[model samples]
Target chain A: MKGIRSVLYMHWRSVGSWVYIPWLILGSVFLINYGWRSFHQDSQSTNDVGNMVIFIYLFTVAWIFNGQLFAFASGLSIKRMHFVLGSVMAAILISIGSSLLLMLLIVVENMTNGWGIDWHTFSWKVTQTFAYWEQFAIYLLVFLCLILLGFFLSSIVIRFRKRGLLVFGVLLYVFFLVISNTSVNGFDHEEAFWTWIGQHGLLVFYSLIPAIILLLFGCYMLFMRRAIIRS
Target chain B: MHVKLSKVRKAYGKNVVLNDINMVLEKEKIYGLVGRNGAGKTTLLKIIAAQLFPSEGTVQVNEENPFENEAILSQLCFVKESQTYPDHFTVKDILLTAKATFPLWDETFCQALVARYNVPVKLRMRKLSRGMRSVVGVIIGLASRAPLTIFDEPYLGMDAVARQYFYDQLLADYADHPRTIILSTHLIDEVSELLEHVIVVKEGRILMQEDVETLRAGAVTVTGEKGKVAAFIQQQHVLSSQTLGNVTNVMIFGTISRQERLQAEAEGLSFSAVSLQKVMVHLTDQEKGSA
Candidate 1:
């Protein structure tokens, strides 16, 4: 248990200062609001640019993980298994923790009446369309998936180093190529696939969470076992 | 703690780094891991540190496999020359983290070293000079108080003063807290006196492993007439030889008897004790060419 706690603490510290992530999320909100408030003639117009800012934050956090993984494994006095378990725990913390913080900011925004300028960064229509608890559940799901996506990408990037990035790019390009070619050449098959996806969209998206998590975890385990510090 | 490696083989894509190596390290002794560059010194250390997985056999620290073994790993600290810390972390941050994680951490000693080394606590690690960064590693290693600590060429960047300070501090601290310390270095002569044992590796194979004094006493270089030196060196393992005019200097390995020495002296041969560094180089040098 001490080893696990130590590994978890190391992972959190590797994420850098405690304030970095929160500041990244909140600072972006305030800066964008400052800019938006300055430019807007009509203050009533609502913008949900927080989603875009938060997505960038997710990407940056994932890159930090990739940068720190090698040293993170050997730095603290912990086994790779402990690190793996602790990382999964940290991932959940980041996901749920960031989600809750964003939700709280939205509550604060409501209290302050959107910083006195009706900036709807956190209180956007997509989230507000749902009931209170439903809204909480929705962000929880979204943030979890977003963080998982970040972790998956980071795991691949760190596990294989530069080769992983090249492969990722190639795979994405091939995927796009396949989609464009099939859609243009055979619209009927594409249309049928879309109809099926529409019928089971929620189920497909939800199932992908575990599939992505499992795939990343598998790759992480296989590579990190033999991983050497790339000094 | 005891560490044993049995038939360990590490290779990468047909390039063998370590080959069929077997070794056992006993508790509470300082060891010098001596080898030339590209001699697989770091690789062997990494294996013992469990930062690397062996390709063939088993490595056990304290009678248990160290690979992902928390019980064993918690008792070890492996410091490297090129360790990287997170960008925003100060030296204080690193020390604090180390203190928190390592159960046997000595905060007072750590802070004392910090002051002695003059490393600023508030400055970010990235901003520190390479030498300063190395001092930080030295501080962490000394203050961690792990039973088995390995420092692999981490003093490469330190100046003479800092290096001497580290050696002195290391010796003083080791005297206070008796634990196993392995200094893997090419600078053999500098640490020869401090080491209880020496392990010499050449091209991924153990050339020799023995106590420092025994290893040094195992060889003697005799200088005299070429014929007398040749006669005396006969039936003895000749490590190296050089012929300067009539004088023939021959480094003979293994011990020589009192009668043999008297006979050699009577035959006009004078003996000189070989430095451990010279012995290491002579023993490992493939072109130990006889002149």
Candidate 2:
């Protein structure tokens, strides 16, 4: 427990400020959108893409932290399990904090009618039907999934270096290509997928719990087996 | 803590880093792991610290496998020559994290060392100079006071005075709080006096491991007439031999009794104690020659 705590504290001190970067970016983008909409006045469309910035930032943070802090912690004689536990705990804490803040912003956006510009940054029309707790759960789960995915990818790179990344990239390209071909051949599943997610709501995110666990497990195996700090 | 490596081997594909290395490191002694570049010094240290796994064989720290064992890892602190920190981390952040990680961390000692080194606590690590970064590593190794502390060329960019200060502080701290210390460095002569035992590595094998006093006492360079030097070196393990005109100098790897020395002196032969550095060089050079 103490070892895990140490790693958590190290993570906090090392890149804690990075958590706010997405907020700063989102704030800037919101200001721009609000100013544009205020001038237009006739534009009633809501901007739902603004919240994606935090997800992207969290993914990047996880990847960089896994690459950099893992080596540093290993140098400090930290156990691999301790590092995994500590990092996962830190990710959870960050998810909780960010989710609560986003929930607050959603409430404020609703009350002020998107700050008088009719813009929807934190509140999406699809999720507005769900309860506050369910919406928070959705955000938290999405954050964890992205963060864990980042950790898994970085672990692959750490274990197998550039070759692993190249292989993964090729596989991802193939996957997307197959999906695109399927859609072009009239086997369109995008609408069905979204409908399913919309029907399931929180359950859709809850199903990702297994994947989160698998990603964490993969990271542990890669790190424990052969993760050396390359010079 | 006692560290034992038996038949330890590390290889990356066909390139073997450490081969068949077997050693027992006892408690409260400083062992110098001296070797040339790519001689497997760092590989052996990493295996011992559990940062790396041996390709074959086993390593036991305090009679337990250290891999993923937090209890054992907590007792070990390995400060690498190329030790890295997060770019945004301040020196104070590093120290605080070290304190939290090591169970026997000494805050007062750490603070004093920081003051002595004059490292800026608030400055991010990437902003610090190379020498200052090395100083931070030195301070962490000294103040952590782990039961098994290993420093692999921990003073890469440090100045002469700072390096000397590190040696003094290490010795002083070791005297008060005894523990096992393994120092792997290229600067053998500078740290020879500080080392209690020396492990000479060559070509992925242990060339020799001996007590410093034993090596100093047993290895000697005898200078005398060519005929007498030849006779003296006969049936002895001669590490190296050189001849200039009628005088011959031969370094042998065996002790000379006082009677033998007196007899040799009366016969007009002079003996000089071989420095640890010289012994290391000769030993490695002999291995190269044999290879």
TM-score of each: 0.89, 0.94
Question: Which sections of candidate 1 miss by over 4 Å?
Answer: A11-18, A21-29, A32-35, A110-119, A172-222, B289-291
For candidate 2, the per-residue lDDT at A14 reads: 52
TM-score for candidate 1 (chain B): 0.96
CA error at residue A103 for candidate 2, angstroms: 1.0
**Interface Cα RMSD for candidate 2?**
1.0
- Top candidate, metric DockQ: 2
Model 1 CA lDDT for position A141: 63
Clashing pairs in model 1? none
**Considering summed lDDT, which 10 consecutive residues are worst modelled in model 2 chain B?**
B282-291
Off by over 4 Å in 2: A174-202, A208-226, B286-291
Model 2 chain A: lowest-lDDT 10 consecutive positions? A217-226
| Top candidate (TM-score) | 2
User: Best-fitting candidate, measured by lDDT?
Assistant: 2
Every candidate's DockQ is 0.52, 0.80
